[model samples]
Target: MALSVVGVVLCALVSVVSSHGYLSSPASRNSAWRFGFGTQTNYNDNELYCGGREVMHSQNQGRCGVCGDNWRLSEPRPHERGGVYGKGVITAQYRSGQVIPITIRISANHGGWFEFRLCNNNNPRARDSQQCLNKQLLTFADGSRGTRYNLSRSLRGDVTVHVQLPPRLSCTNCVLQWTWVVGNTWGICSDGRGKVGCGPQETFVNCADIQISPKRGFQKPTTTFNKNKNNFLYPRVSLVASVWFAGLVATIERDLEEDVLQTVVFLQRESIPDQDLFIRGGISESLRPPGCSSIVESDPCAIDMNTNLLGTIQHYEKYNAWRVGDTRLDWSGAQPGQDVYQGIPAEGTPLVWTTNNVLSPGYQELNT
Candidate 1:
């Protein structure tokens, strides 16, 4: 009898420790990450469950946790929104009508249905609750609603879903919450009148911080343009204007056709510091160079070091990519700035940006 009790306890421990899932692509709060926010890295991030088998709505009258946590339970699990993920870092930015992919990794197969929800937290820090996220049940482009991923049983593996963002919704302090509610657990109904599987069950949650704005790309470059006019080469986004110590400044002008974003880039090679750090900066919107009248169009995302102070904000300038000895911002297929150098050139020009905004193996982004 004693051995049987011990075996049961060990099995419960094993059940809790193994076979859970999390957002692997967008880098959930529990996921392993290096940049963005002060977070403690969890290499084994998938082990956390929302309520697990402990807190059932029928038995405990417990509420589900926000962001893969069960903080409101009788015996609450850790509040993931407060612990490792408190400093909600904006992992990604997208257009309101964009279709993005969410990938989930399940180490052990547990019969359950999963969901992805959103909360446009008014708080800049993205401190949203389960009540807030419940308002925005995200729907995949394929018409699968949140909590509608009813999995009867399945193999343990990675699952990727291509989800579409709502056409009208936009949020700076956005929380994309992923939850997995287990289905295998058997329990009495909330009223103690229903059959098995009619009560509370195991659940897991994970939240990813992101930003979404209405189509900010290149539809109206001269007018309303991509709000984040970041330099393609140097990848650190600076909130303050004067703190940007390196790279070119973008003064987006010239309204063109759909999906074709054309920007007049300026590189202030003079103000750049002699260090491993590189910073990308953006200037005020509208008009020509710093004068708003003396504009020069050399190539796309390239300037011939033609003039000083390219925009009205006379803080930064654009230079020729060949002059800097670095790769181009090839997002628009521009040939001038698209050259790639495997090493730091003999002239010691920092290859701050990458081929398509993705850094190479050696290049690292330094925060401002």
Candidate 2:
């Protein structure tokens, strides 16, 4: 009599635990239940796949709540590894274009077909973090659609399944969902009167969070440059010179008087043996000078320069015309009449050019 009583109690306990099923191999969020942790099972609604119960049913009386649309029991939670359920758990990692092994623990197999779905955590439709609900069916790496794995009769104990991830399916973090619907039940009422029936009408859902690594041996395009290229050799100097020359030309021709004419002349020479000099000049309203116009021109009708001059001689490796050097020229005012022009020289600086307004026309130049 004692042995018979013990056997009955064991069978009763197994019946209570086997009422629902969950993913066991990939370590689901509900794994804590197997070790005497987590909330108690509510047999009335067995859709506790992601640590919560489905409060609503689909239009065809199928399972809901996995998509986070209508979870009646509790709010959605993060589906990461290592919480109250397991120890030092890491998110399951898999590679694209590989076959993944799946194991499910069925307390009492309700005789159903296993269906798998994948959700990209990065997708905008995902509600809870790392939870795979409300996503469309996943496609395998071989370009074939992933459908149901049908079972003819009730299956008890642990069941194993294999799924192939599509070679092109790439995601950093993802959720893999497994749903078991009892055979021939279609997750709907067995009787036409919309009443729940036994056997094929039952459903079990669970999920596992996973990370997908990209395929190995993939190469990315690279950019290359040659040292002998002109642009690569003196990129900064070339850029500066082009910009400066454009600004100088624009300044010489801007805002000319209706009747006044403008002209520009550029002279380059290597005749003075081993020396290169470039001279650029143009005529416009004397109100404008190439480099100092902004400071000196305050009046709209200011006097114009008959001859505007700009000269450059490259000597130093870091030479730039805009910088102050051993020799500097200062000019004030933009009116047609003679304006102040002063030459300040430092030691060892050679005289390049000078001008005396009294000895020339409206503009004067003395070059050495």
Candidate 3:
């Protein structure tokens, strides 16, 4: 009997950890991260606003928490005009036409889809009221109504949704609703049958208080694509060549009097470009110097100087391949001297060289 009880308890614990998530971006009402204001996992019912068990109908009063609610440990405080949390201040302020980053934190991977809804209810408590539920389903700037956006058809961990707020939204204070509905209950079962296939749907809902103002000449962000029309060589090529040439010049200028080992060390440090144009371009074999096109073991200049530069270049290329989602590149082959110049050791393989038991600080500083 004790073993059976333990097994049931373990199964219950596993179910609790299976699927849980909450809105993290635009700062939800529970974003303050207090003890009671965490993820609301009791999403079996339609508690759309703040995911609270009891529905809040008044703008002055807050949501209620059931005493033995097993889903979450604490209940979020009321976030209305005269409520205790946030002091009635808007959680976030933005203008229409701005790309708002919506981040959702998922504790466990579950098959589901996300829905974003917007309503111009300046009053916090009244926003999620039953009367306002239908009114808040906004017609987005693109003329789409009722669940403006959907993401992740399958199970996923953490995800971010970038959405441009409708330019038509000119409300002073508004509530943005985020709803996550579990796609299907495959493992959950009871009475020798699937307890819930995908019937009513287990849904998690949260809201963010935002103030949207008139657009003040805000231009939508765009990426500028400059054609490499000049000599077919990219700015990255010149940058790499310059670093290599600089190191060579420095090595020669300091005279053969400088220790070869010390010069190599200094060159490695000094040759590292201060900018991150190399990795941003997605490092590949195509970026190799034009002069050092093929494996020219015979050409002394290509073999010695270019090979050394290639080593440095390959290091960054390997780092880029590792950072970006490029599974094709053989990261294991990114060892120094893998691409040798005659008998001499060429560039160090990517991410192999380290300082203080970590990759060079420069690689860590890249924005991407």
Candidate 4:
């Protein structure tokens, strides 16, 4: 009995040590951050098989959260009030392809000023690129009405913002919605009707799978996100310039907080990123590398581990390879100019189809 008790105590001590030293270490702190990545797969059987065994192995298949097919997801945008009954919701409307304007309205009360914002995707750490319209005040004291602000070109698409107000003023009759005009009407609109404006319904299509009611909320004092944009309380991204790179591979399944773990290198800009960059779900469509012809037909936005991990890898030596025991390699590299399967050249050799026999399941690695 004493021995068993001792063993249990030792195990607990080891667990604590391991968790602090490795699991919670700066390098591995949030390695698996993703909103619903591990939920399930949505792809058909055939496509799942072709993508490789890793994707096919998931019992849920590609149906997991909003990772595939849809480039956006739905999350409650919270507003705050102190002694005031009304709550504000920051609504974002996507216009053109690159621009999005967000608007906030007070509901349930009126009068006084409210501060609101649109945070970074599920990853608050990703909100480093965030931009604010300003603190909005609606004075029902004078019987005026609510307030609205339009985000500039810099603050649009795949982003979030927050708004706040004081007490006693019940800001009411406010609704958050989107507007789509027949011919190019973009930007935050005062007409809070869904008749073309944006809302949870306009988020990523995959978000439809998960339904949320009364999508807005009151920003609590202990909120997981922050109100000030300059505090550096968000996620940090670093650049390893010169080498081509692609998707993120997580060692374990993570929650919404983990969504900021991935990194991206826009093929168009060969520069090392300086500012903290924010990215939503990766580009859904495939792209070819810049200056490359169509015959190549590769995904431009892919995550390439071959060139990065090639030299140091022990069991795996070749590029775009995968192995059974390997824990990493979870990203999708964009192959811009060449056929995705056209293996990386060896000594200037022409691109050739990689043989499956060598890196086959038990002994092989792949370029997923």
- What would the TM-scores of all predictions be? 0.53, 0.42, 0.39, 0.16
Q: Would you list the C-alpha lDDT of every candidate in the order shown? A: 0.52, 0.42, 0.42, 0.22
Tens-digit per-residue lDDT, 1-368, candidate 1? 99999999999778756867877767777773644445676765675565556653544465556655555543223434445454656677677778888878887666777788888662442246778888888777776544466654556687877777876565544788887876656677778775645667777778887766545552233443343543332235543345343222221122222332222222324434542223332223232223232121332422211111224332321222222322222222223332333442222122232111112121122210
Which 10 residues in a row give candidate 2 its minimum summed lDDT? 348-357
Q: Give the higher-TM-score candidate: 2 or 4.
A: 2
Ranked by TM-score from best down, the candidates are: 1, 2, 3, 4
lDDT of 3 by residue, 340-365 (tens): 33344333222211111112221211
Give lDDT: candidate 1, residue 227: 38
- Backbone N/Cα/C clashes per model: 14, 11, 2, 67
Cα-based RMSD of the predictions, in order? 14.0, 26.1, 22.3, 27.2
TM-score of 4: 0.16
Q: Give the TM-score of candidate 3.
A: 0.39
Q: Positional deviation of 292 in candidate 1, in angstroms?
A: 27
Of the candidates shown, which would achieve the greatest lDDT relative to the real structure? 1
Deviation in Å, model 3, residue 333 alpha carbon: 77
